[model samples]
Target: MSRIGKKPVELPKGVSASISGQTIEVKGPKGTRSFTAGDDVTITLEGTTVKVTPRGLSKRARQQWGMTRSMVSNLVVGVTEGFKKDLEIQGVGYRAAMAGNVLKLSLGYSHEVNFEVPKGVTVSSPKQTEIVVEGIDQQLVGQVAANIREWKRPEPYKGKGIRYKDEYIFRKEGKKK
Candidate 1:
């Protein structure tokens, strides 16, 4: 059995949950979000809690049970408290800005990189070196952050690039005589 699957998800007060077919919808004071249940996973609502179970007795089904449960739980929490991702521009001249729905990035490249921000998600860089991505959908927020970081990943040598605020880049000494 899946230990995480056995843990029941407690619905916060004022938050509502509904499961329809393969989709689970969660609405709270903060916002509303929905995600599809895994193919081998089944969800049952019991009072204020939702129980996640597998549809079969196989190993794959067992593996999906806990993951589906955790994904649903995260969706609920995300819609309630929202999700946030912080990125830092490390290079001296590297920076990011927002214009309309586009993210303008200057990563010491010859040309600026223009990224279109998706709907339902917000991106802001209060400080020239720090970028913040926020949204009610946890997966999308994280994906956007990853995409932004990919534009200019931090180098191990000088540690000069875009990276997560809490991320660590192990640096190596340069060649010396």
Candidate 2:
């Protein structure tokens, strides 16, 4: 049995869920989101809670049981609290700024990198070195942050580049003269 699947997801205040066939839709103050589960699992909404169960004893069914439960939980949270990812730029003269729908990044490159902000997500630059990505979808928020960081990943030597705020870079000793 799956431990996570055994626990039903509770709907918070002002949040509602609807189930149709294999698809589940959740709506809250922030927004609305939907997820479709595999045939191996069944989804049900009980009053203010959501439950997920496996349809059989097969391995795939068991796997889907846990995954389906987690996906449902994410939908609830996403509609309620949403998701956020923060990135920090490090290095001399490296900075970030927002120009309308574009994110301007200076990562020691010869020219500034312009990143277009996609819909359903908001990108903000609170400071020259900080970037915040916010959205109702967790996957989209994370993917956008990763794409921005890809422009200049933190190096081990000088650690000069863009990285998540909480991320730690492993330092490497320089070669002897």
Candidate 3:
């Protein structure tokens, strides 16, 4: 049995959930989100909580049981609290700014790099070296942050580039004289 799957997801005071076949929809103050489970699992709404169970005693069913439960839990959290990702720009002259729907980045490049923000997610630059990504969908928020960091990943030698707020770069030794 799956430990996480055994626990039902509780709906907060202002949050609500509904089930339609294999799909589950959750709505809260932040926004609304939906998730459809695979055929190996069954989803049910019990009072103010949601539950997921496997269809049979098979490996795939057991795998889907835990995964489906986690997905449903994410939906509830997404609709209620949403998700956020923060990135820090390092190195001299490295900075970021938000211009309407575009994120302008200056990472030692000859020309400034313009990144267009996608829909449903909000990107903000509270400081020249800080970037914040906020959205209801966790995956989207993380992907956007990753894409921005891809422009200039932190190098091991100089550790000059963009990186997550809590990330650590493994510094390497320089050439010997």
Candidate 4:
């Protein structure tokens, strides 16, 4: 038995869920989100709680049981509270700014790098050294942050570059001659 799957997802006040076959849709103050479970799992709405159960005794069904429950839970949270990712820029002259839908980054390069913000996700720079990615979808927000960090990953030697707010860098000792 799956521990997580055993627990039904509770619907908070002002949030609602609707089920259609294998798909479940959740709507809340933030936005609306939905998820479709695989054939191995069954989704049901019980009062204010949502439940997921495997359709068979197969290994694949067991594996999907927990995964499906988590996906449904994410849908509820996404519609209600949403998701956010914070990025911090390190190193001299490294900074970020939002010009409309474009993010301008200066990371010790000769030319400024322009990153076009995609739809559904909002990217902003509250401070020159900080970037905030916000959206209803957790995966999209994380992917966008990762893409921005890819431009200038933090180096172990000096720990300089873009990184998550709470991330810790394993600093390496520099050469001493």
Candidate 5:
């Protein structure tokens, strides 16, 4: 009954998958990643394809069916192409730079904010106002970008701050004088 679970994940050329009990490991050009599904769902690898099915008609089983399938799909994509997040800084003198493993940010604060990059993820600053986060894990990449953005969130009035490349800021009208 899960639409997404009904579609098996197809592994592209140069990609392979292995299953051990409730865990499935996907190896691709980029890297290898694994996921462990709940007992409510069963995981199986057929040829180069991965499939997920529910164990019973229970609600938890149905919920895990689609979620497990999506997790498997993410693992495949993560190991193959990886994930990337882009952020840009706004406002005068606001900028970002990379100093070895640390990301230096100048967002109108009194002092520069030094963000130490975590393991398994890479952060780059191609331009003074541009920041790029990359990694094989989608969750890690997104979390790193969010943590950076949290330093100086975009304001509704002027929209001046660090934000995702494609993120939109809803503007509000200024107070009448």
Candidate 6:
């Protein structure tokens, strides 16, 4: 038995879910999201609770069942309450700014990099070094943040680069001669 699958997701107020065939759609105040059910996964709605169960106890099937359930639950909640990701730019002359639908980042590079913000997502910089990404889709928000951070990964020696707000980079000292 899967611990996560055993637990049913409680539907919050103002959020609604609809299941059709192998697709589940969730709509809320923020926006709407959808997820495709796996082959062996079964999704059911019992009153205000959503349940996911697998056809068999196979390793992969069981794993997918739990993950699908969690993803569906997250979709419902994310569309209702939304999701956010914070990133920090570290180093001299490293900063970020929003211009129209694009985000311009200066990560100690010779040329500035412009990232086009996707629809339904908002990128804001409270400070030159801090960036906040918000959207109803958790996966998209995370992917966008990761792509932006990839432009300038943290260097081990100086520990300077773009990184998530909660990410920690352990630094190592140079070898002594």
Q: Please provide TM-scores, in order, for all candidate models, with all chains considered together.
A: 0.93, 0.99, 0.98, 0.98, 0.98, 0.94
Span of 10 residues, lowest total lDDT, candidate 6: 72-81
Candidate 4 lDDT over residue span 1-177, tens digit each: 999989999999999999999999999998988888899999988999998999989999999999999988888888888899999999999999999999999999999999999998999999999999999998899899999999999999999999999999999998999
Tens-place lDDT per residue, model 3, 17-124, is: 989999898999999999889999999898998989999999999999999999888888898888999999999999999999999999998999999999989999
Tens digits of per-residue lDDT for model 5, 15-121: 99999999999899988999899999999888888889999999999999999999999998998899999999999999999999999999998999999999989
Q: Which regions of candidate 6 fall more than 4 Å away from where they truly are?
A: 175-177
What is the C-alpha lDDT profile of model 1 across 121-176, one tens digit per residue? 99998988989999988889999999999999999999999999999999899999
For each candidate in turn, give its C-alpha RMSD to the true structure in angstroms: 1.4, 0.6, 0.6, 0.7, 0.8, 1.4
On TM-score, the stronger of 2 and 4 is 2
Q: Name the top lDDT candidate.
A: 2
- On a 0 to 100 scale, what is the lDDT of residue 121 in model 5? 96
lDDT of 6 at 5: 85
* Model 3 misplaced regions, further than 4 Å: none
Number of clashing pairs per prediction, in order: 0, 0, 0, 0, 0, 0
Q: What tens-digit string does per-residue lDDT give for candidate 2 at 104-164?
A: 9988879999999999999999999999999999999999999999999999999999999
Error of 4 at 49 (Å): 0.4
Worst-scoring 10-residue span by lDDT in model 1: 30-39
lDDT of 6: 0.90
